[model samples]
Target: MTAPIFPLSAVVGMDDLRLALVLNAVSPAIGGVLVRGEKGTAKSTAVRALAAVLPAVEVVSGCRFSCDPADIDPDCPDGPHDFAGPRESRPARLVELPVGASEDRLVGALDIERALAEGVKAYEPGLLAAAHRGLLYVDEVNLLGDHLVDLLLDAAALGMSYVEREGVSIRHRSRFLLVGTMNPEEGELRPQLLDRFGLTVEVAAPREVDARAEVVRRRLSFDADPTSFAAGFSAAESELASRILTARELLAQVALPDAVLRQIASVCASFEVDGLRADIVIARTAVAHTAWEGRSVVDGDDVRMAARLALPHRRRRNPFDAPGLDEEQLDNALDDHSNDDDPHDDGPGGAPAPQDSPAPADSSSPTDSGSAPERPMPAPGESFAAPTDTFRTRRLEVPGVGSGAAGRRSRAKTDVGRVTGSSRPTGKAGRLHLVSTMIAAAPQQKARGRTSAGLILRRQDLRLARREGRESNLVLFVVDASGSMAARSRMGAVKGAVLSLLLDAYQRRDKVGLVTFRGDSAELALPPTSSVDTAAARLTVLRTGGRTPLAAGLLRAREVLRVERLRDPRRRALMVVVTDGRATRRGGGDLEDAYRTAALLAAEGTAAVVVDCESGPVRLGLAGKLAMALGGPAVRLEELAADTLAASVRTFTGAA
Candidate 1:
């Protein structure tokens, strides 16, 4: 027997999540709920419980699409056929979306047999069709592929799927409650997709000992005897189901007061929400909450609850920003709209409105002894002759097929590469290569008795096309932070330049690593990462002092780049060495050693750029010579402003 799902009521804590799910059920017009939390947080448990409590839906008999009898479309074949067929009521289901599901599986495909034998296109509905009028649950939603997420969004937004494949053009209703559960630690959902979810609830593991113990006890009891444990909650489940039915019935009667509407708008505005979706979601949720409570008119409490569900995920502007609403600000906004007659209508419990506290005056004055004296600004640094068109990215070639994942270069079709997939797959093999399939099936076409019409093919004769993708760049910054460079504040200038390059790296989807050389040798400051925050943090506390180990730094960078290349051969490697080429170590042969190491890097196909930080009347131009040895360009320290430096590197690297 299948294991019984934990009852919704049995879920410990996480009142917000329960309410959000309930609100969506009562008013699916509220879209769907997204539960974000770690494992053992009852996220999945609550989602599955929703299926148990959901009332039966009337669907057309024998309709694989689960066609709703009441929503018959005249143009749809199911309309006339299902209308004459028997209609039956079945309990609404929670359809789990598999992670590896393909686009054809999610959306429907052409009937293979009908097309192959009769040469007639017949539509075969997919999982989305079965999910109609039900809850489509996706676990670990953050880990889902980008293409699948886009499809989900489109289906949810349109409430239908329009398929035009294999000479078949059909549209079918695909309305479903899209409930997704994900752990934040695993990965983050795209911002665009996150906003599509009407309600976003964050759950946490039970903190209190009593609650934790209760959860463990209940889980153990259920595991020990699921039948008996589920039997105990049967009556409660029935009552909850009845309650949900009543809430659905009352949903049409739920009213939204003008004040509540205004409050929703105000709260969303205060939070700087991206679009009006939050406002609409909040309003619908408030209506749902009022209906769930068996109330006709919506109140401040309903609005507050709605805001809690709808605004959290939308408030996030950056990747690291936590998903949550500004409660204090929301309360203040709601309080401002409270009725003049009702003075205590601040929130649910007649609490007073939150007010911003006055800012404290500055304690220190310019004349204070404790405060340091301000100095006059120095004159601007001399500007260099910057190239008009300096920024361009090189399109590097590699020996591999592309998976279309981010950071992989998209290129034209080529025969010499790994067999990735066809540019377009729309035949017997699903993604069968048309040219190859036709040629393979040519011999069998005459015996198949379809020669008079045209060339015919069998499934076995199909062949898939392959994609050839180029390599992406990986720029590694090797900075000279020795005592000499630090004394001249060259490190500061280099830091700014590196930051600029990092920004460029982010845009181009290039990977970056930082290696700062000081003291006895060089150390990896920051490992290769796409995160700008990580790079910034590592660079912030980088200290500089001691003799310059130019040769060691070169060797260290070469090893790092070599290892990285081996790990991801699809990445074109580049090293930007920031130094004056002055090797002031005790041995005094470090310059030659560094030049030899640079030549090894060049031989390894690693691009290089040496930024000369030397400042004197008679410059040795050792950095320029080092650049030549590395087979890359040499840039002067004077041309080391963020933009100029970035542009010079881009130009040298041939990056557009």
Candidate 2:
């Protein structure tokens, strides 16, 4: 059955997600967006909505490659098809990556039937070929096979795919906008691979009650009448297309100001972000933002908006430290630089003096002013410069009773309560002293006319040993229940993967928990428990829908861990996220807010592993991007199921 089309404007709350789609539509150079959130966060809806409204592209007919006739480069090896007069027409394509697809299916393979029947080698085009001059979307991208990921990455980077197998070498253009969605609960993406994405935004469930209601309302309405629902928003979709075209034209003339460039740098620097990728992304994103606003010059607001998207994914200095710049720090830096000089003030040399002002208040502080008297205002001609204060540092203190102290107290309390006159068992078997038993027997013998005195009790005569059992580790399964996961058969594959993992968890005797996020909520399906049967059953019935609520899921998983009693006796907590990495529902495309949620979970010391389920033509999506943002390990399901799952789990549990 064909899927119903979703309206673009009806998608609730992710302005950044919408903007990212619009910008990319206008200028693919602005790069792709990474939507990070938990399940049901509407990640897939926005992407599909985008596809529904995407402008049609003119391509050469009968050309499976979707080659643009007008923009054909001189290097075209196809050798200039006749286009001097009339040309055939073709519509833009939107290709989806299926979960169970193989390398041969995705990157084209040797024509087996042709080789056997005709004795000739031929290469069959794959999804990449079909997606040329269109959109290639991978839902749950993090779970994609490594070879497949490599293939897509190669094609995306080179704008072409070269397939060589069975004595056939074929090269073709595979340029297309790649969009991938994932849930961080699945796993994470590799850093080397993650750097390919141009922009990343974290999505979340709508915080406002009304927004969430609207989301549900629209979804229900669409489900009730798909055709009418799609038609209802046709006008708005047309308007959106016009706006995108306007933005595309404006993008060419947009100029990023020097001040905005410095502001972008300042934001990145304040975050102690690694590499210069953040700055570059910020600059490019700012230009896109300006274009989205139909402006020719990048403004301060453009830089601010870009910072929210680009800076979040680049702050990798501390993975557990959150995904983006600290707003308080950013605000302080901006204010510091902006108020660095005051023209109205006068200096001793009759020149304007710099303003001497106190630093901005802390985010949690009530206000900058309190009982302290305000500094005296500088005279009209007097220089007023305050010494810059070094940044202050706060230390975290954790209090707990030492093991030795607890043991001593227990021993002391037990000694005081013991019955002094009563005999107790002692020695290897914790049995009565053998010599004492013999002595008592001898006394009984003596009463019957037998006596002995040379026997003495030995240490071996006492018993005091107890067997100890091995400890169990707690494993948290953070599954992505986002709408993208519901697309095609990805959800079925994810369910199969989860079931397989649950079997392993059961064999290992590890406690497991289940968390799912979709729409505007994240729910703990099951808390950490040793009841493997129940947990596995619940997981088997898991369904996917709504947005990717990544942040909420991470936070909830952490909270679940906190309440779980598995942090001692050589046991550690591990988080395994099975997702595609499309966070389209959380924080409404506000990367900073989404990162804040992820950072909180990481800061609590949860060892997170992200499993990318994004199959077919690869797009990193927000899941992998967030994994990089959190500095977590990311692996594909194929990689995990093939080579790493058992080994990685053993290593993590110190069993290897």
Candidate 3:
């Protein structure tokens, strides 16, 4: 028996998420929804439930591609003649594209061997075909491979698929409501892919006691008796489905007035959004909203709602910056262009509305810390300092090929990356490199003395694709915030350096944690997280002063990393220690204690880099010695600067 889906009408809160899904159903051209939220936030539940409420679709009987009887695809791989074909109505289908699914499974595969030997044009259908005129949902979309994402967005945008892999080319209509649910904590979709989404909604579990309780109550009831719970909401579900159908029909009648158009164009301009895509999306969404509300004309209110859904993902300046629309600016634009019909207004589509590192952690590389000289241990004090500025930094990478999380740092082998070559499969052949397999199979065709004239491919000929792509690493920053290095200007620069490193981490998609040593002990300033914004928040509020207990800081970081490895053992790590390398203690052995802790990290082969903050004609060189102890290089802060990087490299090379 088919499992009952949680009724869409029964879902609580998440008003924006529900509306976004409805809007797309009303008009697929409005594009799809990118639902962002934490796990258990009903991101997937809402999507799956929507399939239940969606109006049933009518397709030509016996059509695997789900062709609309009114307009059959002439180029469909499974086609001949059209209008007279039997038609049937069924509930709209929801197709899922799993993260580990291969390319052959997504776009369907062609029987190359059959064609070469038997002269047959046999083709197999894939998920894109199955999802035709229905809905396609990709859960955990952020974790989906970049190459797969490109394919999804392309099919969504073009409304068709042109499968040209393995020498078999086929075309078919594939218009579906593309919905993706992602947890930002995993990582993020590239901005280019993000902008392709027409609407974006951020969701979270209800915080109110009553609201959360209601959610749990409904969930428990459904889990215990899905059919009974669905039956209870049958009336509400029927009403929503009827409303969606009516909205779909009403969409064509809704008018987009000149003034509403002006508001959309104006709002997009004010936000400085990069392209006219946002404007187009808002216009379509506003029209859909007007129809959805049982109205005939698009109005300012409709535009406002549309802008709320369409502009957040488009206006983000950086991934770390949360997605938001400045309502004040939005209102100003609407008011500013409320009454205007200037042909020279640079109207929509007239022009572009928009606007729009690896570094090694090794000690020899120039890295973290300020340029200030060592100062006396004065009275411990605290201050919250903002980052001085941000600039592009050289890429810092861990020294080996890794098989870690998707990131832009150190290179690793991944199924979706560029194929360097091919290898014989050791286990189950997951990513079969077809051409290589065919090449190996060719020699055996004649040697086996096969009765058949075709190429004789066998299991022994299977080859897996060997691809190379970059992987994200765990970057733990250990900073010295003790009194000995706590001059106001010096500490600010040190924090600035740390902040800069944080930005680098953000860009590289590295999970980052911060450890600060001062006073009597060290604290985990921020736990390692995919969210760089959180780390930066903690960094800005950090205080300086107190005796440096460097050992404690390294120890804390080691503990955090240990826990993290147990959580995700695939991720490699890079330790960045920002210090002047001074450890003062009332009980003594401070420096020795610090060294011993560093040795433990070195023993684990943790990639390390110490940014020597000490500067003067005379130096203690403690930071360099610490770097040596950690089995990494130590470089001055200025060396982290991009412009001076080449000069530093030349200096090191000349010395060598």
Candidate 4:
């Protein structure tokens, strides 16, 4: 049995989040709201609670697609026009979006039942249809499929869904509150999709001991006796619902002055936010907030609150940059609007005011009233974070044996066994043109006297499947962390270089693993992962000492790559070894053994790069020799910056 929802009021702290959700609930025209935080932040709980408290929606009775009663379509499958029933009010629904949902399943598809039973073309509304006039909740939305994300963005933007499949083309209203929850650590949404959300809320775990204890207490109480616990908050829930209803009724009457709109645009311009979407979203949310407060007119406070939610994701140039809105700057912008005649205030298209500008105390939270601290500029010749553009458009091409997964490659004969249901004939192996096939078979079914058999099947009807060109690669980083090479600066440089290459690995759609050799033998310091954060965590506190054991590290990397190849032969492996080829294997170590293993790597056709970090006048050139044996080029340690090294490796592997 499903557990009862925890009341929104009982949610401890997260005043910012609660208010954002309430505003969106009051006025979904604010687009949708995104909740970003670490795990266990009650992101999902808050979304569900919003659903539970939402006012009932009046939908056409027996409408399979949940069509609005006021705007019922005449061609609905249930025949609302011919034998329509009275409109009925139903509780607002919470529709969960599955991560692996297909495009057909997300949008509507051709109804197989009606087609097979009655030889009639019909539509089967998907989740998008069911979510009309309701909440479409997506948890871990960042991890959702890319195609699905695109579909959602288009649907949310248009407030209607359009689907063409199996000779059936249909479009229907799909307006809904798109509430998405994501742990920023897991991954990220594309900027295009990110900006689609009208508001974004960042939540943190309760810091106060008392507040944390309260959260645990309420959670335990709810889990132990949900019925009794929910009963306790019933009155509060009902009141909140009524407030939302009143807010909706008052939304149309809420006033946003021309000055307020200018202030909104000026604030976005100050932040250099891209496009005018931020300005529009802020205006809509400000109006929603005004309605929520039972106020007739939007004030500076409403705009500030709206900016807090709408500007974060939109203003950022990169995903990793902190979500920022200098409260002092924003307040000055609002203040400047009051005095548009002042020349100094309009410095360089309204230059940002002094950082020391005082901020008015927020009535909601005293602790959050202070002006936000300015973002620290990076020092000269220093890098803060990797730019997404560096990796976003890059693709890694692995050697292909035949038709395989989806990516960039020449089309080959398709494997019928691997055929997916998608109608888009990717590559050259997919079945005959889907549209043409449907058209060819459409008119002859009735004359053939087998209409009830659901069209016709024959060998000639079978179209050859097309192959999709998808490629994936794995990068294994083998680093030497022996005491001889553990100089703090050397290790730091090595770590930085690896991080740079990892960015390329991410862009190439490749998995990465790290192996470190020190002490007795080599150890797999980090497992294969696509997440840069995961690799960074393992590299930060990596210990460095003991014998080199280059042989053991080489053997370990070879074994790992071998296993990976066995699992998926199509995935190519590239080993980038960061080491100064000095070897002193603990008990059974041998320099010759390492050289032999390097040759074996070459024999196995595994791409390799040996970064020679041996910086001394009296160098033995063992790293150069190792690189030769492995049939890969050696890169000088001094030449191993992120971009340079990534380009060098990509050029070497032909993956650029």
- Estimate TM-scores for all models: 0.75, 0.53, 0.83, 0.72
Best by lDDT: 3
Task: Please write out the lDDT profile of model 1 over residues 1-656, one tens digit for every residue.
Answer: 56788888777788888888877888888999889987878888899998888889998887777877777755554556556678899889789997667666777776766655665556888878878899999998876655567788888999987776545677888889889999865446666678889999888987799999999999999899888898898998898889889999999888787867877876776676777998999899999889899999999998898888888788664432334655777777677666445543665577754445222122111111112222333223311111111122333322223332334333323332334655434543334454456557777866888745345876677777673433335768898878767643455655555555554554344567899886678888877875544554455445666888998998989889878868886556667788888776777888888889988877877777788888769889889999998888788877765556557655665555
Q: Please report, in order, the local distance difference test score of every candidate based on alpha carbons.
A: 0.71, 0.62, 0.81, 0.73
Pairing residues by index, what is the TM-score of model 4? 0.72
Cα error, candidate 3, residue 17 (Å): 2.1
The root-mean-square deviation over C-alpha atoms between each candidate and the true structure, in angstroms, is 8.3, 27.1, 7.0, 7.9
Candidate 2 lDDT, 1-656, residue by residue in tens:
56667887888778888887777777776556666678999898888778766667776655556667786534333436556524565445778887546566787766655643453555778999888777888887765544567788899888888887535578888888778787765544435446666667778898899988988999999999998998888889889988876787778788877766776776666665668877887788788778877778887777777777766666432111224445666666566555546423456787744323333333211112132123455333222222111121111111121111011111111111212232335422332322233444444444455334333334333332221122235678898777767654566556656655554454344567899887677899987765554564565455566777777777777778777734553345667788877666644763455577667767766667678878777676666676665557566755655346545534433432
| Candidate ordering by TM-score (highest first) | 3, 1, 4, 2
Q: In model 3, which runs have C-alpha deviations exceeding 4 angstroms?
A: 58-63, 67-75, 79-90, 111-122, 162-164, 170-173, 185-188, 206-225, 319-329, 339-380, 427-432, 453-459, 586-600, 615-622, 642-656
TM-score of 3: 0.83
Model 1, runs deviating above 4 Å: 1-3, 75-85, 339-444, 449-460, 467-515, 525-656
Report backbone clashes per prediction: 11, 65, 14, 10
lDDT of 2 at 267: 63
Q: Residue 90 in model 1: shift from native, Å?
A: 1.7
Give a tens-digit lDDT track for model 4, residues 1-656: 56778999889999999999999999999988899998999999999999988999987777766777667766555554433567789988889898766566788677766764565777888999889889999998876655677789888998878887677777777889999998866555657778889999999998899999999999999999998999899999999999999999999999888878877887776676779889999999999999999999998899999998998787554422335566677777777676676533645666654433444233121112222222245344322222112222233233333333322221222332223444433344544544344555667666667734466644444444333433435778998888767776776666666655665554334567999887678889877765644564455446677778899999999989888878777656768899998899656646899999999999988778899988868988989999999988788887765456657656665553
Q: In model 1, where is the ten-residue run with the lowest total lDDT?
A: 382-391
Please report how far candidate 3 places residue 582 from its true position, in Å: 4.1
